[model samples]
Target: MAETSLEQIRSRVDADWNRIVELLKSKIALRSVSAEGITGDHMKRSAQFVADELRKVGVDAKVVQSANPDGTPGAWEVIGSRIVAPGAPTVLLYAHHDVQPVPDPTAWNTDPFVGTEIDGRLYGRGSADDGGGIAIHSGALAALGDELNVNVKVFIEGEEEMGSPSFIPFIEAHRDEFKSDVIIVADSGNWSADIPSLTTSLRGNTCVDVHVKVLDHPVHSGQYGGPILDANTIAAMLISSLYDANGDLAVPGIESQEPVGGLQRDLDESTVRADAGVIDSYTLAGTGSLAARMWTKPSLTVIGFDAHPVEGSFNVISPETTFRLSLRTAPGQRPEQAQEALAGFLESHAPFGAQVRVDRLENGMGWAMDPNAVATKDALEAMREAFGIEPINKGEGGSIPFIPELQRLFPDAQVLVTGPEDPKANAHSPNESISLSGLRHNVETEALLLAKLGR
Candidate 1:
C-alpha cells in the first residue's frame, strides 16, 4: 500500500471517473421511491441496473428475489462475487437502492429523478443519500480488477427508505447464502466535506399511535363551549406533558446516557429557524450536549396530530382525536422497554375522564459496533492511505432498524460503516448533491480496503 502506488491507481480511476458518474446518474434517473405508489417495475429496473453493472465489471452477480407477499411488491437483491485468492476474508457490503418520496419536483432546480452535474457535483434525489455510495461500491469493485484475496458480497435492499420492513425476514431466511466475516454499511455521511467519518452507533426507534376519546361526536362550541370536555384540549395537554419545560423527556423508566466519541456541530440558530420557517426564535427543546441529547438520550416527538382545525371554524368540541408519537431511544436500550415506558406515561398522565388507547406501530433495537475490530482497523488504514486523513468516529441519531438484526444473525462478524456522503450533501432535501472528490476518495479507500483485507 505505498502512497505512490495508491496515487497511480487513483489517477487511473480519475481518468475514467466521468463514466462512473454517468453510471450513477443513470441509476438515479430511476425513481425507486419505496414509500408510496412504488411499483414493482421500478424496483426491478433498479436491481437490474445494479446487477448489470456488477456483471460488466466481471463480478459473478445475480438478483436474488426475496419478495414479501404481505409487504411491498419489490424483492431484495444480493449481488456479489468472491475473490479467488486463498484465505481472503469475506466482506459483505450493504446499501439500499430505494429513494424517499419526492413530494415536490417543483421545489427542485432540476428534475428530482434526473441526475445533474454542475460545478463538479452530482445532484439528484438519491445521489448523496445512497446512490452515490452504491456507485462507489460498484466502481471500487471494478477497480479491484476482478481477482483479489477477499470475497465480497454486496446486498442492496429496495426498501430501506421505507423502514426496511422486509429486510430482516429476508436475511433470516437467507442467512447461509449471505454469510460473511464483516459487514460494511456505506449509507451514512461524513461529518463534513473534508472530514472522514465512521458511524459507531445508531439510535433505536419506537413509534406509537395514540387515540383519545372524550365524547361520541363534535358538539357545538357555542352551546357546549364551557361544559363540554374537549378531546382536542386533552390531547394537546397530553402531548405537552410528553416533555417538560427543560426539554427533558417526561417519560419515566427510560434511561439516558452521556454520548461519547464526537460532538455534534452547532448550527447557527438562525439557519435552523429559517430552515424550519419559524417566525419566532424559540429555544430548541432537549437538555445536555447536542450529541448526548440526540444520540444517547430518549426523545419523544409528536409526529402527527389529527384533530379539527380552526379553518373549519365549527366551534365544536371534538369527541375523538388521534395522534402519532415517535421516540428515539439510546443505543443499548431495548425498544420494548422504551415503548412500555412511553405507553405508561401517556396512560397515567392522560387528562381525567378521557379514554386513551395506545398502539405500537414499530419497534427496533439500537446498534453499537466494536470499533477495535480487525476489519475496522483495516478500513481505517485504507482510509488514511486513500485520503491522508484520520476517520472520525460518530453516532447517527437515526436508526438503521436492521443493524441489530444483522448483529444477532452474525454475532462474530465485524460491522463497518463507511460511505461517500459528506455533511454538505443535503441528503433527502432539495438540491441534494454528492462531491466528486468524496466519491473518488471512497472508491480509492474501498479498493485499498479490499487489497488490505486480501493480504
Candidate 2:
C-alpha cells in the first residue's frame, strides 16, 4: 500500500516533470567546467544562481564567500539553504555545480555546453554526471518547501570536478555552520538504468609521475642504436612491470578483496569493448567479475606517457621520458600509504644506471558506508517505492576525495549517496546524456524520503 504523503509527492513530480526538465536544461547550458577557463567571476555568478533558485523555493539561501590567505584571484563560495523544524534531524544536501572539460566539441551530436533533448535523453556534458542530481535535489525541495519537518542544509560547491581542493578548507573553517545529523551526497549513480542503487564504497586514488633520464641528448639511431640506452624503452619497461601477465596490479600492500555480490554478466563483451574503444588487436586482461576488478581490487593505469614522436622518427636515443601512474586502491586502504609503497617499488626496482624520479601527485583516502545504517535502510525503502525494485549495493570505482574528510568531521552523521545517473551516462566523456526517466524517479524518491525521514 502506498503512503498518503508519498503518493501525493509522486503525483506532484509527475505533474511538474516538464518544468523540472526545463530548469535542468537551463542549468546545463552554463558550461560550468571548473578546471580550466573557469574564472572567479563565473563562479560567483553560478553560486548566486543556485542561491537565487533556492530562495525562490522559500528556503533561506545565501552565497557565502571566503578568499585564500595567500592573495589569489579566486575565492571559495558555498551556496547554502536551511530548513528549520522543531526537534527534527538536520540533513545536509551536497552537490557540485562544476563540471569537467568538454573536449572534442565536434564529436558531440549537439553543442557540448548547450543542453539538447534527443529521443527521451538529455545530452550535455554535465547532464548526468552531476547536473541531473542537482536538478533533482532542487526540484524536490521546491516541491516540498517548509511542508517537510526536518531541517535541511544544502551546500553546493563549484570545484568538485577539480578534486574539491578548496571545499574542505572552507568547511573546516566553518565547521559549526555545516554540522548536521545526515549528509546526502547526490553525486554518484545507480547500478543500471532500471536498478536503483546506493554507492557503499569508493576506491582511493594515488597518482605518481615518473621521469627517467637515460641520456644527456638525442643521438642518431645508426650511431647510438646498439650502444645507447633508450629512455622510452626504460619507461615502458617500468610501466609494464607494474602489471603482471595476468593483468593484476603488482603493487603490494593494496588489498584486492572481491565484492560479495555478482555483476551484470548479461552485458556482451563486444558492447563493452566497443564502449571502451578497445583496439581489436588487444583484449581486456584480468580475471573474475568485472565489478570486482572495477571496485574491490587494486588497479594501475599508465594515464600519461610522453616521449619523442614517431612521425619525426630520427630513431635517436631519447634524452628523457615521463609517464604518469594512477593507482586505484580498494576501500580500507590509505592513499598516502599506497603512494609510499608505489614510490618505494619504483625507486628500488628501476633498471641499472637509469635515474628515475617519482613525484607524488594528488592522493585521497577511500570511503566505505555502513550498510546497516538507518539512513541506508530508509533510502532503500524510498528507492523501492519510486522504482518498484530493490536498490542494489555497489562500490564506485572513482574516488570522491572529500567523502573521507566529511566522515572525519562528522563521525556520527549518516551519509547516503544516490543519484539519477547510470553507467552509460558517459561522464567525463563526449556526448554525455541523462535518462529522463532517471531524473523523474530521483526527484520523486527524494521528496518521499523527506517525508519518510520525518516520520
RMSD of each: 2.6, 2.4
Compared with the true structure, what per-residue lDDT tens digits does model 2 show for residues 1-455? Answer: 23337677777777777778876787787767777633466667777776777676666778776544353434445556565665788888888777778778998889888889898789998898788878878878766755776788888877888776566777878787678888899999887777788887888999999999878878877787876678888888877777788898877766675663445333346766877788999967877677778777888888999976678776577888889989988877888889999988887778766889999998988888887888888888888998888877788888897888998999999988887778778988988999888788888788877767776
Candidate 1 weakest lDDT stretch, 10 residues:
260-269
Provide the lowest-lDDT 10-residue window in model 2.
Answer: 67-76
- Residues 1-455 of candidate 1: C-alpha lDDT, one tens digit per residue: 23225765587678768778988898888887777533477787888888888777666777766756475454646566655654667888888888877788888888878888788788898998788878877777777764445777778777788777667778877776578888888998775566677777888999999999988877887888877678878998888887778979877878786664545453345654664565784777777776576567887788899875678666667899899999989888998999999988888887876899999888989888786788888888887888888766677778888888888889999888877777567777888889988888888888788777766
Deviation in Å, model 2, residue 249 alpha carbon: 0.2
Q: Global lDDT of each model? A: 0.78, 0.78
Candidate 2 backbone clash number: 0
Which pairs, if any, clash in model 2?
none
Q: In model 1, what lDDT does residue 148 have?
A: 49
